[model samples]
Target: MTTVPAVSPAPSAAPAAGSPAEAAAPRRRRFPAWLAVVPLLAFTALSFGVPALAMLNGAFTAKDPSGGASHYTTANMTASLGGAYLTALTGSVKLSAVSAVIAAVLGLLLGQAVVTSRHQTLREAVLTASGVLANFGGVPLAFAFVATLGNAGVLTTHLHLADHGWSLYSFWGLVITYLYFLIPLMVLTVVPALDGLRAQWREAAQNNGATTFQYWRHVALPVLTPSLLGGFVLLFGSAFAAYATAAAMVGSSVPLVTLQIADAISGNVLIGQENVALALSLDMVLVAGLVMAVYLPLQRRSARWLD
Candidate 1:
């Protein structure tokens, strides 16, 4: 009954120094393809990131006599939140809201029309025109509107719509002008969403005995809502931040946040107005950021279904 002791196993051999395993150097970690974007990242940081940080810094700090940041304070925010500045901000928000709503409705209609159209050429033309017109801003669009609608101008003298009920330099008029760009921008923004709407959904709805109206009301509208709302918010930010055409056509007649910013930077003889301008800019940035905060989530939600 005595069993032989089990033989001990030999120890594993160490690899030879020049063996294939040793010769194979650890695969060098190749740089990621995204590293090629480093220059672009650096450029963006220098452009938007640095300037925004400086603006944030200046917004909280008083200007020194030596033209640099001083001690931090809330005076800038207070001043910005009060008086004509407050009025300007309120007016800008109203304008942006009104225009954005109008643009969203009109752009949605136009975008849907283009998307549902039978003619490919018409869709291409519509999109091309929208793309161009969305960017048609600053001095040129202002000048174009002025030439057609200014005092003693063509339409002003010929049609006499002013004699009826139209002035392109007033608040409502500014809304109309803002619509020129806003509507097209909305078109561009919403068009993709419209196009992404799957035909299968419509077919499924029909197969389930759903009418066109029911299909749209239940399925399409819900799907489109995020994209629509996101675009509206984006349009709001655009209108809120616009300085050029307002300055050119309406000038101080509007008293918009953007125009106020310009006046603070250039028109004021008082000390520290520059800081005030920066503060105003800060206010605008905050509002725009808020709008974007809303837009980003909606955009993400939309992408989930669309993509």
Candidate 2:
């Protein structure tokens, strides 16, 4: 039998004119990528970089106690490195650490509740209320708590606890107030991390005879640990550097570095020491830096998960 001749394969066509490669090769150079950096450079110079440098300079300079002009010196830095400064800085760090822990724990629980709740309306209401109240910081929150928990507060009178052992001005009271705001913040920051957990893993854990606590302990906590730590660090920074809330709550009775700085700057001190105020601001920076020491690691690790 005669077989038909095999057909020849068609030749491949050339790429279309001005294909991506060709187009990219002859592209006109409009602007360098560095052009995009100008606005950020301007902002950094004007807002953050300049101010930070100024503060750095101020930290080194000693102010004249007799109301004269302050000048640059190493004395301020040297004196600030002494015992009194270390004590205040340490106290600030301790207070911040406590506040961060309280905030993060409360926030984690609140986020879990909001995320897992069956009641949509209730969950929405809680989130809406939390959002509104989250922005309520500083003096406003302090007064809100004071009005309700003060010696003559509504609860105090109603509960017949007029002389409640806890005063609004006490250290524990400050922690509570910091927590009131901190919990909501944690809810906001952590909801995403909690939500990022794959539902299938949870279901798998459950199917494998894992209890709810077991699933969380084994599967969830490990994945979310970085984010949780980051949130805690953020809260620590916020509570550590917070000024107005503590100031409005207790004034100088329990002096914070921020309050101490305010006293010096406003010229309300017995010694009229502006240099000390500058030094305190520097101490605040160190406290923030220490928090970053913890923060940077979690932040770096968290980025890998995002990828």
| lDDT at 258, model 1 | 85
Writing each residue's lDDT as its tens digit, candidate 2 over 143-200 gives: 8887888777787678866554767777777888888878888888898898898899
Provide backbone clash counts, one per model: 0, 0
Q: Which stretches of candidate 2 lie over 4 Å from their true place?
A: 1-28, 63-71, 81-85, 162-164, 270-272, 301-307
Report the C-alpha displacement of residue 274, candidate 1, in angstroms. Answer: 0.7
- Which pairs clash (backbone N, Cα, C closer than 3 Å) in model 1? none
Candidate 2 is scored at a TM of 0.83
TM-score each candidate.
Answer: 0.83, 0.83
How far residue 29's Cα lies from its native spot in candidate 1, in Å, is 3.5
Q: Return the lDDT, model 2, position 268.
A: 81
